[model samples]
Target: MKVWILIFVCMFSMPLLVAVLHFRMRKGQTLKIRQDYVKNARYFGRSFSALVEKALPEMKNGMIMLSRQEKVLETDGKQEFVQPEIEDLIIARNTIFCPQQEDLHFQKEIYSEKDALFVKENIRLRAVYSKKRLLFGNKIRLLRWADAEHAVAVYDECDLGERVSSGEQLVIGFENVFHSLYAPVIRLGQRPEEPDRFMEERDPRIFRMPVMNSYEYNRHYIDDDMVTEGGTVPYTIISRGDIKVIEDIILQGDIHSDGAVRIMENASVLGNIFAENDILLEKNATVLGNIFTQGNIIFEEGASAGQPDKIISVVARGTITFYGGNNIYGYVVSEGGGKILKSDREISGEYCFPGEPVHEEKITFRDLSEYENVDFQGFRGDIYVKEAIIPEGASVIPKSQFFECRSLEKVYLPESVSVIEDYAFADCHVLKVWESIEKLSLKSVGISAFENCYALEFVSLPDSLTVIGGAAFAECVSVNKLIFSDTSLLKKIGDHAFRGCRNLKEVYLPDSVEYVGVSAFRDCSSLEQISVSEKIKNQPGIAELEKNCPNARIRFREVNSVEKE
Candidate 1:
């Protein structure tokens, strides 16, 4: 009887032990899976942060430090320093100090210290203990230090230049440093590790000086009709009145005027420009940076501003007009009316004409087949038609040429058309089928080309398509099918290309696609299927689409056998 009870107990205990072991192992796996998910999420966040940093202006590098015992030498009625406070200094390895005396003063307290100040080889200033001053409210008191590798000593206010009889060892050298003679020096210590990641990277040419009620204009050219002649101005030019650059001059810095600023033909500005009144850029004038004005802004023919890769802007509180043939590479914002004369030239960025919203005025086309070979060169305003066919010889479609034409139903593009500039057919709510009448020779579609076209269901891309700019088809909520030709040369799909397309069910990507920008298909709730060649499986943007559309099925096909859906 004793042996029988022992066997039964052993059998029951073995099963319990096995069950407990299995439970523990499963719990461990679950915890590890959760940790891995968090890690991946963090990595994605970092990648997006880095991408945003890259898009913005690069930050300024290095630090600025002032020397102790530097006294202000009074000369005439003005005081000058023995050594100019603006002299550059080397603080640590890879760290520099170049303070602008005028802008460096008047800083009350340090903004940060943990990542700003480094001391001794390992210790870093972590916190400020007190607001007490060491030399007449000039020096700040530090409270704590992090990663201290050596013992630290503190002392009361005393002349460090004189030797003390006290035998206390000073681990670090010390003296009351004058950050600035006038303004308060708020920031100190080492420069940021990645100094090239800053907002509105300070234009190095901006005159860093104290705030003043007004600026003095260069009186050397006061007698001359043109403020600047055919020479380079190395520093920023601030004018109290109207200024004109009559000759071919190169400005290394920015220009600011309280009145009108006029740049003649053949002039170039490498920095930003601002005016309280009107600004006029003559023909062939080029500005590498942005332009802002409180009054009207006018660009003559062939005038160029901004760069292709930079985010430059042209803003005017009043009207902005381009007299045709201007090549602006960035955004333009006008509070008042904006007009661009008809020309073959192109503006390559976003344009905001928020003045009076123009409603669509439809012109009925009953026999659209008769106008199949119509020349659309001087065509303007809205057209109401059932079926419209583009002529075979049409070469270009200007910006906003058919904007907000809600009555448009079906439109056909011609083979000779190469460029469709920004907002060419934007806001056409009822436009459905946009097909090429012949083999398409289309090369580029500008920003917001088919945006907000709610009834657009099908779009057939041509074999010659190369680039689809940002927000090209954003908010096209009813697009159900998108087909890329078998011999498609499509290379890029810009940001927000198919965003908010709730009814889009299927898409076929070609093997020639090299880049799909951020949020290319975001908010496509009904996007159920995506077919792509196996060549695009390793693309970074492919993961973005998968993450945004969790329920969408991704079907990878061999390069030669990409099926049309």
Candidate 2:
């Protein structure tokens, strides 16, 4: 009995002991972990210069300060001055300025409170930071970077190196090859004291925005990997596998890949690029819009991004590497980091400019009688079709029937046609001239049926359209309104059916819609209102449409009884 009593006490004591030990070990201790700072790169530098000045005085890591204007007289009648050889810190006493000696090569990062002037010849520096202003005279070579609190003025023949950033203005006098520069006012081969043109000009006489057209929402569905030869592709590309550009080429729209994207030397892309994997830009490659990647972004020599007139963004979840001779007119940001790798020389090759391109495939197509199963697939010559009339008594439009008709303007469907198969009108870049389909029996539209029709305007679907397939009518930039009759039978809207319709302003759905697929109206930036019947407002997918279009107002209205007849 005594042994049993001891066993019972021991069981409770063991747990008590563990609790005491756990509390003792954790006492007066709080976990601390170092996390990398993530921020929007566009607004990152607004307070950087202020933060630098605030933190510099309280810095403790081997920093020397000349706080007093005069030497301190000690009690022993001794005076001492620490003239250290370290070039990392320079605190000016009573605003006294000090300059680097002539022809000196600075290996470590140097900071100064006064003006940093490198007027002498052949002065090489790894990097420089100044609190006031920075000036680089002729024959100065910056190996890595240079930043200042105020202006960073470069002379006519200096090597500006990888990055030159300033909190205020940046002035470059002459043609000096540079990598990346970030400032509000950048004067290239112009004077800083002269009138500022980048900010002042209300309307430029020379520069004007061309015809507004965009294919940002078009996700071209290529099944497998693609290997393209040197040529011009006049549409967007979406591939499940990797895309390898063998030679110089030009793409007129956005590019997305499930795998990697490697643009060969001398290629040009006139739209945004996104990849699930890494994105590589070879020698002298150019991309006009933004570039985003889940992986890294690697820039080869002589590669360039963005135009001189505007700023673009290059964001990476991983790192960004610039080998040399790479220029970006905007943000270069990465969650991991960005580095400037040294390269001895720029890669020289045949560059492909965007100027050369043959006219669209010309064919005044009138009918699809020659196509297989009465489909338009027989006309695969990338032709410019003015209008195509679906023959009388045609029941279905086959898959990929009108794929990539370069300038297909209009299409007329017969009253007997009921279904449009997958990829049926995809890549019809300018197909917006067609009017209402209220008379036809369009029961269902297959996947990606009318994707990438950039100029499609307001669409008024018939009451018979029951199922809208995935990505059907996606990327229709000019599609501002979509309408359905009060008595319409639109049972479902497939996933991403109207995705990337940037100008989609309003939607009017019928009371008969049973389901709306995920992300049906995703990325519709201009969505103003979504009107639905009051009876179906609480249905399965009815409430979720507001999530896809967050700025759009959901209007639940009572349906008119006249259309029920």
Candidate 3:
């Protein structure tokens, strides 16, 4: 009897222990990129710089020279592909030094530790790493890449060949061309105008209090693939299958897809594009906001992301392909490395200034045969539900899976469900979930998963919740109580998460929360108190939180500092 009881205990307790460990591991691991692309892109160059240092340790095998003459005599820079000792780089005082001067070709990599590095006019170099600063003269070109710790300046008509980056400031002169650039501040062409200055100067629109008349949010939940050829879409789109946007059009809202996304010629989107599969953009296509994906991203000829003044992000976890002349103003990163492809039209294997075109078969937009398009738009995405039940053992409840299902209240989730993806139950007014689950095992609630649910009164968060993405509960006016378990592993509350929640009264942050993103609890007029530990209050964006909630009293709870992973 004792043996049987011990076996039963081990079986039940082991599963529970494993579940706890899984959530703990998930909480500890940090993702490099997500929906908030523009905010997190500042670290792109520094991350690559670290990887470059590790890969080519010879670059840092340099020493500071006593004088400019000693540095000049160290390496005969006129020749190409000249092999030197491990300390191949030259470090001197503030002097104009070009390793490949006579023939204008420097094949070896250069690194400077304590001095500024400068290059002469019309020179071609392999790679350069500057510890202090890097400056370039007229019409210079780089074969591989260049980066600096302090600042980088390029004079007239320079061609920053592949990747030129600076963690601090990067300034470029007239008519310069490059494939990619990453910096906190990047200026171009004698321009004094700041990025987003135009946006700030625009006349503010008048806001009139809206009277509730409709329950639908004009945002479409298309069951089949939908094509956006030419027209105006003033609302959001949640697509289930592959979506194609051909021709020129301006979209005022975001586009979220479960499958691939193809943006054809001259199309411009004012919002974001979040895709599960690959994203393809044709020539002259523009996205004012972010473009992110788990799969590869391909750009066609003259295709641009972001603006000349405003900064945005174009990222892909898989390989990123740029078919010449494709430019991105801000962050352009690919975990699987970036490739620049010339057109198949030209047989010559030389790279050109304006870049060659992409050879692609342009296809017409196709609306699938079995298309079922459902569009809804409301004051707060008003679709009503009282109760619901999910199928047992279902690990994922995909976004817009229950599009037309109403008359649901409390949700019955399987213990295996770890993530509720973006817009999974969005606008489901009065939808109360998590009462029937025997074991609470949820980890992540994706972006806008529960937005605009005005009838929701309370939500009890379990300890397993780690991430609550952007605008998760925005405009939920009737949300009165939000309970977070004492042992919660919540680390991040994303941007505008609880924005415009008029009736929310109070919230207490667990010690596990490390970050409260921009405007996470903004516009909560009825919020009376926000209790958090001193460590949470000292976080980077926590101070800005108070400015958003003018009426809320932020009470810091006295507690021991929590150890972070």
TM-scores, each model vs. reference: 0.34, 0.35, 0.38
Clash pairs detected, candidate 2: none
Sorted on lDDT, highest at the top, how do the candidates line up? 2, 3, 1
Error of 3 at 321 (Å): 3.6
Deviation of model 2 at 398, angstroms = 1.1
On lDDT, the leading prediction is 2
Task: For model 1, state the Cα shift of residue 75 in Å.
Answer: 84
Q: Which lDDT tens digits does candidate 3 get at residues 1-565?
A: 9999999999989999999998888833223234224343334335544544454434323432222212222343233334423223443324433444433555555655433344456666777776656777566777778877766766555767677886555655455656666754444432211232322321111011111222223233322133234234454556777766666655545677888888777666556788889998887666666899999888776565654323467778887776644445566767766655433332123211111112112111122211112111111211233444455555665665443223334566667688877877666655654563326688988888877665655556767889998888787787776767667889998877887898889888887787887777777888888888787776644686667677888888776665544
Model 2 superposed RMSD (Cα): 16.7
Question: Candidate 1, clashing residue pairs?
Answer: 59-196, 63-97, 105-183, 105-184, 106-183, 106-184, 107-184, 129-143
- Model 3: runs farther than 4 Å from truth? 1-89, 101-127, 131-145, 149-163, 167-181, 184-231, 308-311, 323-326, 340-565
Report the poorest 10 consecutive residues by lDDT, candidate 3.
202-211
Compared with the true structure, what per-residue lDDT tens digits does model 2 show for residues 1-565? 9999999999979999999999888834223222224442323233433444565566564443334121211111111223323334333423313343456565555555666666666777777776777778667878878887677776555776777777555666543556556753344443334443331221221111121133324233322233234234555677777766544556655687888888778776766788989999988777767899999988876566654424567888887776544556556657765655533332233211111112333333233433322212233324435567666677787787777775678776678888989988787888874555788888999998888878777668878889999889888898888988777888888877888899999899887776776667777889998888787676544566666677899898886675442
Best by TM-score: 3
> Where is model 2 more than 4 Å wrong at Cα?
1-377, 380-386, 535-541, 558-565
User: On TM-score, who's better, 1 or 2?
Assistant: 2
